[model samples]
Target: MIDSHAHLDLADFDHDRAELFNAMALKGINSALIPAISEQRWENQLAIAQQYHCYFALGIHPWYVPEDINASLVSLENMLAKHAANDRLVAVGECGLDKLKPDFDRQQQLLSGQLKIAINMEYPVILHGVKCHQELLSLLNRFPNPKGGVIHGFYGAPELASRYIELGYKLGIGGLLLNPKAKKLRKTITELDIKHFIIETDSPSMTPYNATEKRNTPLILPNVASEIANLQKKTTVFILERLNKNFSQLFELS
Candidate 1:
């Protein structure tokens, strides 16, 4: 299986990152897409990807937008250009709007800039939307990335899922599925095909409701897949096979 979105590059895994990767591999998670949240984390993300045989994306996440958003966008463009030939450098985000965050206007600007970069770079996007579905749809309508992307950590209704799928975006199914209280989300998953979704851990964050550890890890991926399998009334192997195909197709992996 593959983790479509995971912040494994963050400091949260500094103590046992290597050990965790080994554990994840043994758990059948062959790779993860480590997305950048800020300019400062890009090099470390690339380094981790290189060492671990993982893929990564470089873009400024909405939460980490700097005071000079324009300068950051330029740097992101240069970085993408510099590593254009690097097959491991896939996609252009972890970037999108969040309604709960402050400076809604600035967040829109940052997301727009990143979308433009993604479009120009011909890369699929790794989007994050929290209670900003309508806003995200509107912005996506304006930008219209043909390469498509995944809506990371998706927790919405069937209508919303269809809307994103219509736009060529896959719904990210992650730790949210483990929450017993996520009735609507589970129902939505039951109604949708596995092709429209990809698995993610979002490690060190979005801890599953049933998790024993405080911090999440990619090792939880099989459990996450099992949750989806139960929701879709399928076996774990069936879910993983299709989800792995979705992951490979999105990032153009062999």
Candidate 2:
């Protein structure tokens, strides 16, 4: 199983990160998408991937767009160019627009810049579009068939959901759907073509509904998989296998 998205480099997991990785391995989730959030995180993320044999994504997140954004983005281009052929560098993001962020203008600029980067590099993106779905959809539509990317933590209407899939983008179904109260997302996810969906934990952030611990670990993947299974009226095994295939295709995992 691919975690599809996670931030294992964040300090929150300093204590049990290894144990959590071991637990995930034992759970048959042998790989994960470890997204880089900031310049401070690049070395740690690479070190963690070197240590754990996982994948890494490097891009400036929208929320953290700096005053000298060009410098940071240039750093990202250099990072990708240097490591593009490295098997461990799986995707081009943890990057995209975030309307909820404090600086919408900077976020939009950063998002467009990264989208261009992803297209140029031909790497799939772990996108982070939130309330700006329409804006993103419009951008994607500019290409009759864009290379496509994952809309991480997707929580949108069914019509908009279809619009993303129609645009060649895959929807990421994660912690949000675990809530029975989130009927709208649940229904939208259920109706989505399994081929166009990727299961993600977004661990260390969006924990399952009854999460008792403050730190969300990848070991809890089974619970999230179970929730998705229940929604699809299928077994956990079936869900994981299908999700695994979807993730492998998205990230070109072996």
Candidate 3:
């Protein structure tokens, strides 16, 4: 399985980072996509991908946008250009709008800049939208026929999700599905085609309900797949197979 949106570089895994990778491998997690939240982590993210033989995405995250947004964007663009042909660099984000955070306008500007880069390079993106789906959809529509991407940790309604699907984006299903009380999201998932979805852990965050006291990891991906399968009334093997194919197609992975 591919853990499509895991922040494995976060300090949470500092002590057992290598062990975590082994655990993920043992649990059948074939690859993971570690996204950069800031320019500071871009090199570290790439190093982690190289060391672990996984994948990574480079973009300024909404929450971590710098004071000089333009300069930061310049840095991001330079980095993207430097790694334009790097096979491990699969996408252009972990970038998007977060209404709950400060400087909404700045966030939009940063995301727009990165989106332009992604679109120009024909690279898929890994987005993080919270309470700003409509605004995000608008920004996405600005580009004509942009390459597809994934909306990580999607908890929006079916209509919003369908809008993204229509725009050539896939929804990332994370630990949110583990909560039995997330009936609305579960129902939305049921209504959507499984092809429009991908499984992610968003690890070191979004800990599954079953792992109440522990930091989340790619090791929990099978349980995530099982829950998704249960929600879709499909078998676990079928869900895994479909998710693998979807991940491969979305990231152009082998």
Candidate 4:
């Protein structure tokens, strides 16, 4: 299976990154999508992908937007052009709006710039939207016909999710499913078609409920899939197979 989103290059895994990749491979997670959050992390992300036989997306994250947004955009564009022929370069983000963060306007501007890059390159994006779904939708409406992308760590009502799916975007199902209090998100998952969702761990961030501590790893991806199957009243195998197809379609993986 493919982990649709994961920051495997984060310093949190510096000590055990290699060992964890081996564990993930044994757990049937053959590949992953490592997203770059800053210009500094792009090389490390690419190195991890090259070593692990995975894929990556490069873009300036909203949280890491530099003071000179124009320079940051220029750097991002240059990186995209430089890696355009890299087989491991799969998408264009980990970039989107987050209302909770500072500089709301700047965040939108950075996100718009990256979205334009993704559109121009004909590459799908991996978005991160937190409490900015409506704003994101409005921005996405301008694109009209995008190459398709996924909204990572999605947690919201069915109607809101439908809006994204209608725009050729899939909702990423992550550790949020492990939360018993996520009634709204759980119900939304049950009502949506499996094709509209993809499995993700968001490792080193959204730890599953079964995890002993807050730290997350791709090893818990199966647990996420099992919970999804239970919520959908389907077998784990069925869920895995369907998600594999969804991953391939979303990222254009062979």
Candidate 3 lDDT? 0.88
lDDT of each: 0.90, 0.79, 0.88, 0.88
Clashes of 4: 0
Question: How do the residues 19-124 of candidate 2 rate in per-residue lDDT, one tens digit apiece?
Answer: 8888888888787888878776798889988788888988888778878877877888999999977888978788877788788887877777777788888887
lDDT of 3 by residue, 35-72 (tens): 88999988888888888887899998999979998999
Any runs in candidate 4 off by more than 4 Å, and if so which?
none
Name the candidate, 2 or 4, with the larger TM-score value.
4
lDDT-best of 2 and 4:
4
Model 2: lDDT to the true structure = 0.79
Q: What is the C-alpha RMSD of each candidate to the true structure, in Å?
A: 1.0, 1.7, 1.2, 1.1
lDDT of 1 by residue, 68-131 (tens): 9999999999999999999998899989988888988999999999999899889999999988
Model 1 TM? 0.97
lDDT tens digits, residues 58-129, model 4?
Answer: 998889878999898899899989998887888989999999899999999998888898998889988999
Best by lDDT: 1
- lDDT: worst 10-residue window of model 1: 245-254
Which regions in candidate 3 have their CA more than 4 angstroms from the true location?
Answer: none
Model 2 steric clash pairs: none
